[model samples]
Target: MYPNDGFRELERAECLRLLAKVPVGRIVHTRQALPAVVPLNFRLDDDGSVVVRISARSELVRAIDGSVVAFEADEIDAGAQSGWSVVVTGAAAVVTDPAACERLARTGPQSWAPSPQEVFVRIRPELVTGRQLVGGRTLYGVDLPS
Candidate 1:
């Protein structure tokens, strides 16, 4: 049998809660038949979906729509060498409905990039998983695993 791991799995509810604490994530998708990862500012919806603003002309607009994609967000403590990471995988759909778009635009994260960001894409998570590193006390009195 394998040795006990120091990482612990996070429950679904806890994963969502942790996701809510972060405003940015990396979205992985297919671009030109190759894998592509892009950073985006996003927000978590009540239904456990991730919403992000994209420009109409962005390549990701076409690459992600109607496709399955993975989104990852993490918080790391370099000094402590402990952190948590969350990955969400699901179908991504472009929000074309005017009413829905308007609602999301009002509540979604603001785009940090310079663009009109008129398009909104929603990733309805089918799988959400997270892991956190368990830490122990260090010589510096910091609670980090050696």
Candidate 2:
């Protein structure tokens, strides 16, 4: 039998740090009275938010804007038994500002999948949390004091 683990608070800054390094994450939001999770290539902004590029008409784009959303990023190394995960809950909006979008476009997302027009989405983090698993049994979490 496996042990039940408790969840801990993760620091805001640490969560951003881990998220910035991870290449991909799951962005979760509500749609049609249901929950939807989509894998996305994301870039972590300096202000503890995430920048993601998607297709202009993607369903996620429609559902995310002006809404509360959750974003999660994780990296696992089975060989070393070490891994880290970060979660950000916040409001999402479409980045329509030309200057900001240009700036984001410059850095580019770390991962690219087949898509149509490039759509830029930004998530302004209200809360962020993270945890790390090490040596198969040890779990360390960063507590972001509210």
Candidate 3:
């Protein structure tokens, strides 16, 4: 742990492990020349890529595909005052291969929307960062559950 702060940097493998435990994340991307964030459920691919399932016609699909974006997921316990957050930055691409799509349909995260047509967008994790709050009631000068 850091001598001053209760937050500890998580290793890349630990970040991916923590990411796998969570089901939802926020995708940060550009929308109409402005930055936007959308909360969505996702799954971690075997290679650590983030896979999101959304409606094929979703504006997000077009906005994020082939673009560089950030994906963030976190688990926080307000009562306990502790948790972890992981962020992955990478290029988002729509899964266009029929065979891969079929495979994802069988194994990927189920969509939250009732859309007849859905597409899988995979974000290749080029950069991953994470931190864990070793929480308590207080830490150093700050208040936390250390």
- Which model scores highest in TM-score? 3
lDDT of each: 0.83, 0.78, 0.88
How much does candidate 2 score in TM-score?
0.78
Top candidate by lDDT: 3
TM-score of 3: 0.85
Q: Candidate 2: which stretches are off by over 4 Å? A: 1-9, 77-82, 110-116, 134-146
Which of candidates 1 and 2 reaches a greater lDDT? 1
TM-score-superior candidate, 1 or 3: 3
- Model 1: residues >4 Å from true position, as ranges? 1-6, 136-146
Tens digits of per-residue lDDT, candidate 1, 11-65, equal: 8899899999999999999999999999888999889999998887877888999
Clashing residue pairs in candidate 2 (N, C-alpha, C atoms within 3 angstroms): 10-142, 10-144, 11-142, 11-144
Which pairs of residues clash in candidate 3, taking residues 3 or more apart in a chain or in different chains?
Answer: 135-145, 135-146, 136-144, 136-145, 136-146, 137-144, 137-145
Write one digit per residue (lDDT tens) for candidate 3, span 1-146: 22335557789999999999999999999999998999999999999999999988989999999999999999988788888888999999999999989999999889976599888999999999887776674322433455
Predictions: Cα RMSD each: 5.8, 5.3, 4.5
RMSD of 1: 5.8
Clashes of each: 0, 4, 7
